[model samples]
Target: MVTFLAIFTAFLIGFLITPVLILVLKRLNLIDAPGGRKIHNGFIPSMGGISFVVGAIISVLTWFSMSQLIEIRFLLTAFGLMFLLGLRDDMVDISAWQKIGGQLIAACIVVVFGDIRFSSMYGFLGIYEIPDAVSYGISIFTIIALTNSFNLIDGLDGLAGSVSVVTFLFLGWWFMQAGMIGFSMFAFILVGGVISFLVFNWHPAKIFMGDTGSLSLGFALAVMTILFVDSNGNMNDYEGWKFSAPIASGIALLIIPIYDTCRIFTKRTMKGKSPLAADKSHIHHFMMRMGLRHDQVTITIVLINSFFIGMMFIGSNLNDHVLIPIIAVMAVILGLRLDVITLSRVKKIHRETPPILSLRERKKKASKPNVNKEILEKVNLTQN
Candidate 1:
């Protein structure tokens, strides 16, 4: 079908373009160096997001018409702006406020121009219809917050791309079932791009998506979420496929990133630190401290997200008021448990590994003398 072809085209383009981008990024020395919050070794090419973003754009344009789908233009426009902002930040790191300002502008374009704002809360706490101004504000906040949430989770190899693939797959299938072909196409197209990128972005990753992929893809996911909530809210009870707790269901799909971001922000604020200050307080970081490998942590988080999505489907009969609270409680419990267990593991590791030995191990891990000189030369070619 046309949909499958679009996905295939995007996949093929991403699969082909990623290696070239990796080569170019390394040649240009546009690589992420491991230090501080970064847990990787040596240097790895970044901004590899360009490959998949271009692939998705080309694939969408090849099959979708602007005239027929006017909103698609606005969506793509906002997407491009987010991508550019992220690409710029990746090249020469931008201040946090500047990045947020860019996200705000992109969010405004989608909400004000594309009219993708949430119209209702679907009876969560007896709130049905929202005021226009309130709706716009909430929608814009949601978009920007979710955009950063996804970006924040891009800490581990394959984490962001894997989460994205899971989100889009669910959204695409749901959109198709909801009779929204355009939305389904949009989701599936990006799904292909991210999946292909995962080929080079898995454990021992050769490349990172950087902000380029995270911001744009996260923005797109936010847009789809708004659409999903709005469309589901308007559905009648006669529609057998309609979920009673659309808002909660959408939250379930994004619980991992959203919950993690909110928790980290709160923890930082309570400790009198800037919420945006980069640290290892993330759930993934804690999991890693608990001795989980990169791939294992990524898969575990993905499974956790899938579990929430499955719960949403099974609890379709529940209203947002009940289901949302339950989800929040569960998330809080899970986060607390993870933090407690990781702390114990960290203490155990400290006890097992003497401080002198730890320092030596850190030095050995940080310096990769065994790496091929030719490979280093190839990556640092432009330096000379």
Candidate 2:
């Protein structure tokens, strides 16, 4: 009952605050403009993340005690840093290096101060334990990677937020079953905040989460994932809470963003482009090209994510060697098929509408205004 109240309070706060934030952003001319590579048609406020952040924080403080606050202070501090970084980027474009540096620093804080580093492999690849140095390295890398992966997946309207909502719901359920009420409450609080944000972020979005929301969310998820894996490994000896394959289960839960990021980065590198170079090659973009509307694409991806989570539950008794391989193969096959479809569509479009001139020449022609011979003649006569 207390958990229910927390969730509802968070949701109410987000739902109530978003419209006002939207108005404030508009008044300040803080909007994301639609143009090349963007799908939206008009300017939409990009700082909608602020509303949910406020809502989630308030809900968390109301439910948590002073001791709980001290225990998770590092994690909360990291989240705050991410939020600020994202807010700055949304207001004024920051360089890629700067954003990455900020992520690294935040990740380090979580590992060093929050004491959330992975201490073992959980018997994956026959390795039960690892050195502290190696553990910190891997933990920091995972946090940075997961954080950026979430940001990368925030392309379409409601896509990122919807995926996150599904993820938090599953995480919350699992944590509750494992008797980790604190983590469970945190996950549900996030779900509440995101749900309210999604109310305005659906199909025709009224506002975008921008960097603030995505970065903060990604950071939060990273922390949660590490804690979940660590706790499950430590409790594996227990009867009711043993997760037979924690590593594999974690990967399965985050398969969509992780897989999509890897695939896109590989494609970009193959084309001799920087892996971070923005383009319309994400799976969501491919789905859009395949005639799926924004809402349809969001819903489809959410369902696919849920399906993978269900797979994790079904295969919980299997060894990592068996379950991880199966999941990896299935994910790879799906990615390849999507790539092929997207490539085929691109080739067909090129074949049907062959370019009449080079890109530079086309640009020149487009820039010049058209004047018919009769119009020119009339102008000449009038001048004479």
Candidate 3:
């Protein structure tokens, strides 16, 4: 009951303060303009993430039943590192490379000091065991991957923040069940903070979380479920209470972003493009291009993410074999949907361009001389 109250109170405080902060940022001209690939709007303050962070941090620190300073030294260090990195990027746009490097650095700090590492995947990949060195390497890479996955998913208003609220709630609950009360408190505090911010951050957003907020929030989430591995080198204990519940819940919480990342990488690589290259090809972008408005896109993705979370949770209770097939089916469905969105299809179709047109034929059309050139030339001549 106390936990619930803390979560509710934290969210209310955040929600209550978000509008005031947005107004302040707007008055100071620290607002984002509707330009480029960003959300369409005149200008909105992009500091909602900051407010959420502040609200959650203060709430937890002030009232959490944890130690005065911090129980885990490296945890605080890693968070501080991410907060600084995020705040800097938010203020002055940093390149993606820099962001990647920063996340890696923070992960390494935890790896070295806190010793949070993934020991195994409980035979998810059919590997029953792994070595310590292998465990550390895999865990660090996984942390970075998961951290960026959350950040990349923040392309639409309310999508990232709302999904996060759901994710953290599940994680916090799992933590409590596992007897890790401090961590559970952290998760609820996060949920409260983000929900509060989302009040003003919904569609027709008055403020954005910007990179500062997204990266920081992603960092916090990443640390919660990301760095911890099986610790043991066997799958026999993978289903242990602490291991299975936290692992399964964590994956479900993040399945949306992780699945999307994998889909994008595969699609891009198959098309002879670099996976790291950025384009408006994300799942959210495809839905928007399909004529979904900001709020609709936000609602659709949030609901889908929630569905996936529920499905994954169900799978977690079953055998690995059953879980694998379920995941494959979901992946196939998402892949087909993504394939339906293409430049050829999106182009204003003068006619029903064949669905299976070869690249050669497409390029041939590009190489062909414009038949309407004379008409355009005539029109230009008349205007002149």
lDDT, each prediction? 0.90, 0.88, 0.73
Query: Across residues 1-384, which tens digit of lDDT does each residue of candidate 3 receive?
Result: 777777777787787788788878888888788777775667778867778777776776666664623544576678768878888887788888998899889998877667777656666657656788887788788788887888888888888998888778776776676555777787888888888887777887778888778877777777776633242223344333433443554555677788779878988999999998787778888877666678897887778778866775565556555655666577678658655754445664524456556767898999988778889899999999
Residue pairs clashing, model 1: none
Is candidate 2 or 3 superior in TM-score?
2
Q: Candidate 3: where is the Cα deviation over 4 Å?
A: 67-73, 227-250, 338-384
For candidate 1, the lDDT comes to: 0.90
Question: Which window of ten consecutive residues has the lowest lDDT sum in model 3?
Answer: 227-236
Please give the RMSD of candidate 3 to the true structure: 8.3
By lDDT, the candidates rank as 1, 2, 3
Candidate 3 TM-score over all chains jointly: 0.80
Give TM-scores for every candidate, taking all chains together and pairing residue i with residue i.
Answer: 0.90, 0.88, 0.80
List candidate 2 segments past 4 Å from native.
Answer: 237-239, 340-384
* Candidate 1: residue 250 Cα off by (Å): 1.7
Judged by lDDT against the true structure, how good is candidate 2?
0.88
- Rank candidates by TM-score, best first: 1, 2, 3
lDDT of 3: 0.73
